[model samples]
Target chain A: MGMPLELNTMIVTKGREKRVEENLFVLVKEGYRLYPIDIPIDVKKTMDSDSSGSAVIKKVEWENSSTTITYQLVSLNSTN
Target chain B: MGMPLELNTMIVTKGREKRVEENLFVLVKEGYRLYPIDIPIDVKKTMDSDSSGSAVIKKVEWENSSTTITYQLVSLNSTN
Candidate 1:
């Protein structure tokens, strides 16, 4: 493969890390390689009740070094 | 590009659909083309306070048709 697809993750410290890993692993078994994006951990706000967005790190390998995933929001309702 | 990467999603009526889409979109513009895997929306439990782990749909495009991202959970503490 060239550059792997980038996936952002967050460990809210709510203790769902395992479940989240399980979620991520599901994707891995499909074919894509895993490589964690190496960047300064950012204290960003994310979904969930936790005040700290707690970004999930240790992403995965794939792609031709695109750096990260990309895309812009287009709708409130995703029908496609 | 062959088959686009497959991502599983769930839309619990918890009201984070917009946020999740925003999350997914972040990945798209990165070089991925999304396509929803047409399956009967499975009523499964997910990670959250929400009882139903509503699956997000309309994944993207990229790659040589592998059908989904792949990898396996290898550690409790993801260092890489």
Candidate 2:
């Protein structure tokens, strides 16, 4: 059998992201997933939320069945 | 041009790994990389080092030009 994995084109933070630095954020997710690197992708507070901003992932770490990602916000669609 | 990516069949930790549980470990590496999911692969302290163990990758994540993998040690070839 194979592990369940997902390929994503966006970041749905679900309000669990932590600000690691100015314009940079880190988020941890459950399970194995894939995202495009060095490219811009949409970021939202949730899957159903409106697009909040654009970000470029700078690092991703997976361990203990969790995925941790570091990203930098490139642009914001709205302030609120 | 497309992003640079590597498909890896083994893990060379280089002593940069953190043990999360008894048999589970996490490793993060620079650059986008791919590993087989749910299958056993070689694990070593370095590329030149002998295989330390066999591990089944449970998760692989790519982001920001880095690859993160979570694996479970299945069998060890040595005690050291």
Candidate 3:
């Protein structure tokens, strides 16, 4: 048998006031043990002249520990 | 050099009235031309006794055309 892998996906958006908020999905798994892991932002970029996005993944805590990963998307202003 | 690959990510959610709604991301690319492609639902599942999720991808229209993939997440009732 192999270790289980938990997969999670999230879409982050900025509110009308430009406040950052995240809508998180409950941990979902197919055939692996589910564990909560934090994902770090691997990359961030702005696009479409309006939106900013970031990719994040949880740091690997242990060699055999289950991990959860998440990505955040946001909108950026031209000035910033 | 290899063909360009366009990547898009979306987080879909159900509204207060149990209506399915999707927050779409404008096409974002790293180093490829982006052509709008529809993503079909490949898999669907329910989790946490509350949320229903589905993975979708656009059918491969051409041998070397850019593709766009999207995943939709929605809340489900236990009855269905």
Candidate 4:
């Protein structure tokens, strides 16, 4: 069956450390049932600051089941 | 518009190291354009042997665009 769905993308920075980490851990713990794959960091972009970086995180949540799978594009240099 | 699709899942063991790694790298390099989320591993099962482990990998590819996103659930102990 084809399911109608919406995809959400988030760009997280180093300053959002706590939020990002928390979200990531949650996704890691519960993502498998929703997605058949592992979340990978594909593209990374570094900003001017040493401690801050920008990344694109893709999260796919099933509209019917409410299950979610999250993937992260981490800045290679970002400490978080 | 909703697209008709099929999802493929693979179970990989340590013996298929090279194939698994190659497929993973390809998915990483080309996955973003397909899905909006990162792939995560929620469950891992370890076998009797020390060097081998088993995992489930989910890959989503667009039938028309031919874009693919790959997620890996690696055996935590698998070296490669």
Candidate 5:
């Protein structure tokens, strides 16, 4: 099987405290949506983090499904 | 269309400070693997969080793709 094609990804390096509506729009702008109550959001987040780990917020669209969107957002992991 | 079949979801409500190796095993035990570096881990973490928010680890397997697992683990969001 081919790797899950990443249609898009957005990193929120600034403004972790922004409104949830704004954070949600970030995904809408990128042509993606939230992954729903299931799926592992934590693992997906780790994938987006850089070595410094300032990065947060991710939106992904799988290749096979046009309707399924993977929207992820983390509030700049406090450990950083 | 039917909802993305949730094959399995595991929640870890304790031991957030354990080693990464241990975390990886947590998923393996649940028959799940961490999603690649393109999915949203942050959002997944939030999904795992209960109203009290002590939960951290998550492991999920998609029904469509057995090999494609969604394993997530957050270090107990500090705010919680």
Candidate 6:
């Protein structure tokens, strides 16, 4: 049998992201999801929200039925 | 060129693990490494140490030249 996994092309933080360092942020979500590493992806506050910035996913961790991702903001669509 | 990756069959915590919940732990280490997910693997305090327990890796994340892993301890070899 195969494990259920989701391949994501963008991030939907939903206002639950923590800044670990300058331009680097971490977010945890509920489920087994995968994202392309070391590649730039769009970051949105919510799925329906506009693209807030572009980020490169550095790490993606799945544990306890949850997914944690670490990303670096490379470019912002808006400063506000 | 292909990315430099290491496939690891066991976990070497080096005493740097933090408990996330009962029987669940998180460990961060240097460099990008891969582990068998959803399967039990040996856990050790160090590369030269004996197996402390068996754990099932739930998640593995690589970012910023570092690797982060989350696993659940299934059995411990010692009580101490």
lDDT of 3 at A16: 18
Summarize candidate 4's per-residue lDDT along B1-80 as a digit string, tens digits: 32333332232232323344642522322232333234333322223444333343354433223334444545455456
Interface RMS deviation of candidate 3: 17.5
Tens-digit lDDT track of model 1 for A1-45: 122432444322323223333323112222342333444222222
Candidate number with the higher DockQ (2 or 3): 2
User: Which candidate has the highest TM-score of all?
Assistant: 2
- The TM-scores of chain A alone, one per candidate, are 0.22, 0.94, 0.22, 0.25, 0.23, 0.91
Candidate 1 vs candidate 2: which has greater lDDT?
2
Clashes of each: 42, 2, 10, 14, 8, 0
For candidate 6, give the lDDT of residue B5: 62
Q: Extract clashing residue pairs from model 6.
A: none
- Fnat for each predicted structure, in order: 0.00, 0.58, 0.00, 0.00, 0.00, 0.58
Those runs of model 2 whose alpha carbons end farther than 4 Å from true positions after fitting are B11-30, B37-39, B43-53, B56-80
lDDT (10s digit) by residue, model 2, range B1-80: 54677978899999998899999998989888878777898999988989999999876777656777788999999675
- Give the winner by lDDT: 2
Model 6 CA deviation exceeding 4 Å by range: B1-36, B40-55, B64-80
How well does each candidate superpose onto the true structure, as a TM-score? 0.19, 0.67, 0.17, 0.22, 0.20, 0.59
**Chain B structural similarity (TM-score) per candidate:** 0.22, 0.94, 0.22, 0.26, 0.24, 0.90
* DockQ of each candidate relative to the true complex: 0.02, 0.40, 0.02, 0.03, 0.02, 0.35
Clashing pairs in 5: A41-B41, A41-B44, A42-B41, A42-B45, A44-B40, A44-B41, A45-B40, A45-B41
Q: Write the per-residue lDDT of candidate 5 for residues B1-80, one digit (tens) a residue.
A: 32242332333324333334643423222222234332323322333564222223232332223323233344435552
- Supply the TM-score for candidate 4: 0.22
Give the alpha-carbon lDDT of every model. Answer: 0.31, 0.84, 0.27, 0.35, 0.32, 0.84
Summarize candidate 5's per-residue lDDT along A15-50 as a digit string, tens digits. Answer: 223344543423222222234322323322333554
TM-score of chain A of 5: 0.23
Residue-level lDDT of model 6, residues B1-80, one tens digit each, is 42456768899888899999999999987777766678888999889888999999887877777788888999999747
